[model samples]
Target: MEWDWNFVRQIMPVLVQGVKITILATLLGSILAAAVGLVIALGRRSDNRIVARSIGLIAEFIRGTPLLVQLYFIFYVLPDVGILLPPLLAGVIGLGVHYGTYTAEVYRAGIDNVPRGQWEAAKACNLSSRQTWTRIILPQAIPPMIPALANYFIGMFKETPLLSAITVLELMNQAKIVANSYYRYLEPITLVGAFFLAISLIAVVLMRWLEQRYGRIEP
Candidate 1:
């Protein structure tokens, strides 16, 4: 059968709207993940062994579970406990928490890469803990961590398709709706792939530029 250009035009607007939702989910989720990850990373480095161990266990639990399962639990199970969230909100929470665990590890690695002497020097200079982190450690750690964080942002974008499982009207969810309505899978599925490819390629280029600008020194 010949490609239906008319059908393509008809679906383009809806699909573009879906793409917007997908991007928004990714953006919001990335912000949550970055914030939560930093908290987890700092907690793991806490002087209190109990706090550090407790945070580590929590991170492991998040990282070990499937994101889809987490999404289901948050979207479906939580409602049973009277914590009803909208579909998209539940999806973003799942994505953020699930991926936050992974981002925590990346942040840990960056902080670890800071020279040991830097911490000692800050201590010797009697810098407050906040000052040590804000003025010294983070400045050194965050730059090298940019590429990894961007990579996870792209990963989160790709994972937005999973949001469809929870009834979020994201790209893949819209494609499924269109396909079911028309019984035509080719166009919508192909469009989903093309959109992901385009966005991923763009992210990779940006990440490369970031890496070049702020990459850590290598031996």
Candidate 2:
């Protein structure tokens, strides 16, 4: 079908709303993923073998499975067992937890990259575990992690389209709705692609800035 300016104008508002939801999901999911990853990273490093192994296994399981299946389990299966999350909330959880496993490795690598001398010095100074991590190790480790973590968040943003499977009114879903209603795929699909391309470019620019600003580690 020929491109229709009028249909494009008519659908812009709906697509804009979808864009908002998509961004909201990405932002919330990224935050949750960061927090979850840190906890998993720490847990895997725990002195308790049980805790470490359990956490490691869970992380590996998550990383091994498909994200779509996880979303289905969270959104569909949970409701059967007395947990009923709204679609958006469920989508966010799925995205966060799935990506969190991958981010856990990034966190582990970052923490491991800290000099052994730093840990020894912390011990030599008789610093508490909390104090050592907060005051020294994290400060050194987290800077270089920013670039890698930012890359994962960008990946999460692209993966937001998967939310449509769970009934999220994200950009792709909105485009599909418009396309289905009008029986014309070209305009809405093209607009959706254009929208994603524009936002992804912007995100890449921000990621570049973050890499330059926080990806460096000082001697």
lDDT of each: 0.92, 0.92
Report the lDDT of model 2 for residue 156: 97
Instruction: Quote the positional error of residue 161 for candidate 1 in Å.
Output: 0.5
Listed per candidate, the RMSD to the true structure in angstroms reads 1.8, 2.1
Mind giving the per-residue lDDT tens digits that candidate 1 earns over 2-106? 578899999999999999999999999999999999999999999999999999999999899899999999999998999999998998899888888988988
Model 1 global lDDT (CA atoms, 0 to 1): 0.92
Clashes of 2: 0
Clashes of each: 0, 0
Q: Candidate 2, which segments miss by more than 4 Å at Cα?
A: 216-219
**TM-score of every model versus the real structure:** 0.96, 0.96
TM-score of 1: 0.96
